[model samples]
Target: MRFDLFHTRVDAHIRKAQEYLQAANLARIEHQIAADHHLALASMYAQRVTWLEQELSESVSRFSPPFRGVMTVAAEGGKRGAESVVSLQRSAPVSNG
Candidate 1:
């Protein structure tokens, strides 16, 4: 699924969870059974939101490129020289042959 759509669905679930919680709170004063049902629905939505967030995080990390370094430009004698200013170590294990 597309990231935007996934994000929108997550947001919708969050709103549903919030609405259910509000309903549960309101129902708690008059009907305990109704309150319990709403609470259960809220919990289900909350769990789904948690799962979706974790999935989104993992998906982003999986697709993101590893940061290697930053390039900086220096001027000397009217000439531009490009140099890597910051270098980062690779996250993956390096193998020696």
Candidate 2:
């Protein structure tokens, strides 16, 4: 490939990387939201936990093979944080306002 063409391809890859990063951030946000929902549910949190799992699974599914591995790892970490938040919320009842 010509130098310019090669550089263009590289640029495209960079943009894809950025998009992946954005998706990863969004996944993290989704996890946080689910955690909040779970906390709000407290004793009735099983459904919310399932919802969180679905959100994470969907986000994980949306990833392309090239990106899935990294996204999966990052998403796992985010999900853990979310679960922790839910646990804390359950431990102490709090108004959802």
Candidate 3:
């Protein structure tokens, strides 16, 4: 999936979890069953958010070294030029499929 879309999905899950937690807190005084149901939904969303975050972290790590190297090179006044960046990109393994 596209990184932007994946990020958006993660954000949505986080929002859903927060909303559910808020609903549970609000309902706890008057309706125990409703509060329990909301808490369950919140927990499910929280778990989903955790899983998605891990996936994102793994995905970023796959390309992090080359990108980080390029950034460092660039920060040092680009003495190595763009060719080094290209080579770094080419050398990185393509694991995502």
By lDDT, the best candidate is 3
List model 3 lDDT by residue over 8-71, tens digit each: 5777789999999998887775688778889999999999989976775566567756665665
Per-residue alpha-carbon lDDT of candidate 1 for residues 8-45, written as tens digits (9 for 90 to 100): 57777899999999998887766877788899999999
As for lDDT, the candidate ahead, 2 or 3, is 3
Give all TM-scores, in the order shown. 0.35, 0.36, 0.36
**CA RMSD of all predictions:** 24.0, 25.3, 24.2
Q: Rank the candidates by TM-score, best first.
A: 2, 3, 1
- Report how far residue 17 has shifted in candidate 3, in Å: 39
Alpha-carbon lDDT, every model? 0.62, 0.72, 0.72
What stretches of model 2 exceed 4 Å from their correct place?
1-8, 43-97
Question: Which regions of candidate 1 deviate over 4 angstroms?
Answer: 1-30, 65-97
Instruction: Please give me the total number of clashing residue pairs in predicted model 1.
Output: 0
Note the residue pairs that clash in candidate 2. Answer: none
Ranking by lDDT: 3, 2, 1
